[model samples]
Target: MSTRWYPIYQRGGPQLRVFLPNFWLKLVRPTHEQPPNVVQFACSMEMTKYDIQNYLEKIYNIKVIDVRTRIALGETRRVPVKGYIVKDDDTKYAYVTLPRDEKFVFPNLFPENKEAKKDEEATLEQAKQSLSDFMDKNKERPNMPGWFSI
Candidate 1:
């Protein structure tokens, strides 16, 4: 019996299969300005156009009009320690085209949070007070070790 992972589909249910790829896809900012409909992604080197199309359509439920991919050759350099030649892994860049009406913008990963900001400010204040206290204690006697005082 084939087990559907999403809804746990069983007998008499519409059987839908999910493809889990061993590789990973990283959403990357475009090096150059691109149309709003075009989204750039850095994917596994082994991924093909068809694989990328299938992955977006089936997994992300994104309708992809076209997919173009290119491989960027890795740089060859000498290792720091033994000066042995080493080569970095080649990377594949996939440009996925969405429908003209649709546009995608990268979301902001770091947004201001009130609680986090407060915590950061508190930590900064504590650090400043600590430094000032240390300076005051050291001002009484110059060149004295900090461990000498309580």
Candidate 2:
């Protein structure tokens, strides 16, 4: 018998459950120059080198030749008003090395559009010129509101 508080366990019941690891990895842009085959990643502090390698191999399907981890100490600061010390959470960085021939390039998340910029500048210039012309035409009626013009 099954109740709201408890349920009866059966031998052949659905006992299968999906397994998920409590690990997270985020690709980070390298601050300094690094080898082309080396990729930087920010990951959970609890994850080890082996875990990182296995995660990339099994989950991401990326071949990892080696993984090196380092823990960066969080910044400590004192609140100006309360005068209490605060510290940020520590971050774990993983350096994963790929095959000798593999190269990892950091993607440009924000690309500049020269054409769009030129168009925006042209629109702004037109608006400014129209405003100047309107001001010149209304020089005789300086006290009139801008919206009251025909």
lDDT string for model 1 (68-114, tens) is 99998999999999989999999999999999999999898998799
TM for candidate 2 is: 0.75
Distance from true location, Cα of 45 in model 1, Å:
1.8
Best-fitting candidate, measured by lDDT?
2
**Candidate 1 runs further than 4 Å off:** 1-19, 112-126
* Segments of candidate 2 deviating more than 4 angstroms: 1-18, 127-150
Clashing pairs in 2: none
lDDT of 1 at 75: 100
> What are the lDDT scores of the predictions, listed in order?
0.87, 0.89
lDDT: worst 10-residue window of model 2: 1-10
